[model samples]
Target: MTALKRRGTFAYFLVLVTMLLVWPMGVILMWAYTPWSKSVKVAITICLTILTVLTVHSVCYFRIMPS
Candidate 1:
């Protein structure tokens, strides 16, 4: 008898929660612990990087502009 491996919902939930609480650590956890494929991980990393860059750029631009 062969038993299939299943990742629990709690683990996924934890990842999401951790991401909300501490993004950098959560990203590290996602890479280190999760069984997700490399392509998925790379896609997520790219998305996060783009989002971070956009957010910082927007904040900086807004802060510098006159009212």
Candidate 2:
């Protein structure tokens, strides 16, 4: 594979792994390093934001009270 292809593959894996494990950094990396268009990035950003909001709301709404 060409150097550019290898770099792109590496960036892809890095973004995927980081998105699962450490997502704030992953967003930055996706915007800065990946070849995705602005619209795709914006869509993913919106989805991630919505997911985060839902997760936070679920946790806050479902917390157990101490006896």
- TM-score for every candidate vs. truth? 0.80, 0.88
Q: Local distance difference test, per candidate?
A: 0.81, 0.89
Model 1 Cα shift for residue 62 (angstroms): 0.4
Q: Candidate 2's residue-wise lDDT over 1-67, tens digit each?
A: 9998998898899998998788889999999998899999999888988999999998877786344
- For each of the candidates, the C-alpha root-mean-square deviation to the true structure, in angstroms, is 3.4, 1.8
How many residue pairs in model 1 have overlapping backbones? Answer: 0
How many clashing pairs per prediction, in order? 0, 0
The candidate maximizing TM-score is 2
